[model samples]
Target: MSTPHVVVVMGVAGTGKTTIGPLLAARLGVPYAEGDDFHPPANIAKMSAGTPLDDSDRWPWLDAIGGWAHGRAGLGGVVSSSALKRSYRDRLRAAAPDVVFVHLSGDRALIEDRMAHRQGHFMPTALLDSQFATLQPLEADEAGVAVGVDGTPEEIAERAVEALAALPEPAL
Candidate 1:
């Protein structure tokens, strides 16, 4: 039997991480975790106030998510995280060595429009630029797929699943 991978649905704000992660998890028959739920109140407050978080503010949040990923390791699961920087992804990989990422990619204009229309979310449209500036696309060596976000959430999740299937399985 093939090993089940813990999938991290990643992208900038409004790239549909929250929306797609659960669908992807459902498709994969794994539990889904909201990355924002891992953040401390302070981090949420900072972002809610239109302030972008620095590395220091992110470590704990990343650690919390990492811990959850670590626990879900072999059993398989899905989680949503912005994971904008290479270092942040590295931290997650360290915790769950076999985890794979599904990066929801899209142009700035579309993402900004989505953010503007979304309600009750902590991240503001004002922070969208910062998110783009911080995003570092997955490198060649990373065990991940960059799926475009130009379709409905179900379509995007389907693309992600198809892309993930194309990846070479990790060596034991």
Candidate 2:
């Protein structure tokens, strides 16, 4: 079988990273990972208590996820990460140089509505503003695509797959 693309489905809280990640992985015939699962308990607690995590708290978590991405680099998989800042993405890229990102973007109102309706998530709605403030959209040189979250998860995943396919293959 051909190696699958290792994709990081990224965005702020409630942009549907968790929801869309599995769909994208399944559509691409790859394994799926939830980035939140890599978080340290302390970090989860902080977010659950409606506090935004500091850089120190996030670095280890990002490194863990990046390490996971490194493990799956050639094997292919889909994982979700907030990846709210350029520096965070760079850290992940450092671990998995070939990884691609799929940024889920949408209007603030829509994201807030989703977060409000979300259940069983550690991230609280009160931290949504902080998340947006920290989010830095993918730059032009980045190996990724920004898919708007205006459609069903399936539609969004479809668009992601198409976008990934359209990208030129990495030079050896």
Candidate 3:
């Protein structure tokens, strides 16, 4: 079992994908893709206005992330996305079978705190519940780490990377 190069940093809003994704990618010597980049203009506007997006607004963004992750994984890159629903993850897997989804778990209060502290982000704190409402924790069948983010950013990232290290590499 070889280690998968494709990884998604996931969780509800404010779980720190934006914070840790780049560091992880740098450690792995791969470029990191921000999931927000794939969002349609309308979707961005909706979120920017503190509106929660329904599945209809999400499918296209998820598909784009799927495509980007698959393409990058084939070339040994990593992506960070908040693929909230199981169906979304499934859609992503359809494109990037080799992906490992790293789940960043934390309490609503903590996430809310982080979101409140964050500045100049399009995602409003008001949308936190919608994010939590949509979030589906990673399952046993998924290949990845699920770290509880009730600690420092370094600790959380370290735990995730440590977990990733423990996964046996698939035979090349």
Ordering by lDDT? 1, 2, 3
TM-score of every model versus the real structure: 0.97, 0.96, 0.92
Judge candidate 2 against the unseen true structure and give its global Cα lDDT, from 0 to 1. Answer: 0.90
Candidate 2 C-alpha lDDT tens digits along 1-172: 1357689999999999999999999988999999999999999999999899999999999999999999997789999999989999999999998888999999999999999998888888899999999999999888898999998989998998888888777610
- Looking at candidate 1, the ten consecutive residues that score lowest on lDDT are 163-172
When sorted by TM-score, best at the front, the candidate numbers are 1, 2, 3
| Superposed model 1: Cα runs more than 4 Å off | none
The TM-score that candidate 1 achieves is 0.97
Q: Regarding lDDT, does 1 or 3 come out ahead?
A: 1
- Candidates in order have lDDT scores of 0.91, 0.90, 0.82
Considering TM-score, which of the candidate structures 2 and 3 is the better prediction for this target?
2
lDDT of 3 by residue, 1-172 (tens): 1443788888888999988887777766678888888899999999999899888998999889888887876565667788888888888889888888889888899889999999988999989989998888887777777888887777777787788888766511
The Cα error of candidate 1 at residue 15, in Å, is: 0.3
TM-score of 3: 0.92
